[model samples]
Target: MLFGAKNSSNPRLQLLKDVVLFKDLSMRELAMVDSLMHERRYLADEIIFDEGEEGQGLFVVLSGRVKIARFASPLEMLIELGPGAFFGEVALLDQSVRSAQARALEDVQIAVLFRAEFYSLLETHSAIASRISFQLARVLAARLRQAVANTDRHHEAA
Candidate 1:
């Protein structure tokens, strides 16, 4: 199979199911999303995407770990994500510059859902697109709330 056989046991399909963006998708829907995705392997310390680069799309860690970092004066490391975690979701909405860079902490396998491919899927499957878009919004909202809470705590501590 060109994109891996469409079977219940397909690891890629399972990985897609575990991601927040595709969590609501059924097995059949996962297969459709899988079709739009391409796999890439990166070695430890390899850059996946750099901050300020044009955002490509969402990247899900299929295996190993990925580090999301902000390259400021001190180079702050933001988060380390393992299998099934996803990043660069903002690119799905528009091809803006990335705010952070992603690197492989170890040899990693990633599934990339490119913007053009996602748009094509949206046109062909609006229902699926709507579901994913809504989920993305919810995820962002939750993160925003957490950020606000942290800011409030920081202010109180000062």
Candidate 2:
């Protein structure tokens, strides 16, 4: 099946249930989010976004996989994202350039939300903004905790 082609009654609703960023949203809020986002499909090996490029929005993986890579001194594999995962969130929050490159590892379908649309939606729906802010904070906290844990592990190894 090609990415973004699903048989579900409501693909956006299904996505909301699967993605942490949207899990806290109500049905109405989900519908709002659905309206602001667009679905796109990419073939395997396609470049979703290149590093250092201006990031317009974030992408939620609907199906297939993606690899997040960076080039520092030498090329490095940062991480791989699968279904229900998201990337480019930092750019959404700050409107900065992307810190890494994302490439499709398989035929992939993704839901993308542009910064202007997202901010406009948030302005129109305060509850949706609250929910998204809460989720983003949680994600950031978790990542910080993970970084601390990794640092401790490295220190212990040394």
Candidate 3:
């Protein structure tokens, strides 16, 4: 019901509406966010962004899969994302370098929301921005908790 009474058009809009970070956004607010989006495609195995590179914004997976991995001493894999998933959101709040590398697991399509545009939305649409920011904070906190739990388990095993 959040994406508009279900229609043939706006599949991308519907998909984004279901995504966690965008769920609280209304259809109109989503359209405003959509206006700032630009689509890009990548082939399997292509590097979408490299670890240590500057993160410009959030990358929403529209189609296909993405593999997020790190290049540290252990070279760990962070996550694999599919349609309706998003990453690089921290960059929207803090323009920091990426902590992991993103690669296309297959031919993929993504919608990119640039940082400047996101900030502009935050200024002009505070309500929508607050919803998204709250969601982002929740996700970050959950990830932090998971990491701590994993570390505790590792120590116990050791």
Q: Give the clashing pairs for model 1.
A: none
Per-model lDDT: 0.91, 0.86, 0.89
Of the two candidates 2 and 3, the one with more favorable lDDT, higher being better, is 3
Model 3, position 96: C-alpha lDDT score:
94
Question: How many backbone clashes can be found in candidate 2?
Answer: 0
Tens-digit lDDT track for model 2 on 1-158?
55443334466577656789888877767877887788899999999999999999989999999999997778799999999999998877886899999999999999898888878977898789778878988998999999999999999999
Q: For residues 30-53, what per-residue lDDT tens digits would candidate 1 score against the true structure?
A: 888887889999999999999999
Those runs of model 3 whose alpha carbons end farther than 4 Å from true positions after fitting are 1-9, 73-75
**What TM-score would each prediction reach against the true structure?**
0.93, 0.89, 0.89
Candidate 2 wrongly placed segments (more than 4 Å): 1-9
Relative to the true structure, candidate 2 has a C-alpha RMSD (angstroms) of: 3.7
TM-score of 1: 0.93
lDDT of 3 by residue, 25-102 (tens): 888888777777877999999999999999999999999999999997887888899999999988988879999999
For candidate 3, give the lDDT: 0.89
Count clashing residue pairs in model 3: 0
* Candidate 3 clashes between residue pairs 3 or more apart in a chain or in different chains: none
Candidate 1, residue 21: lDDT: 86
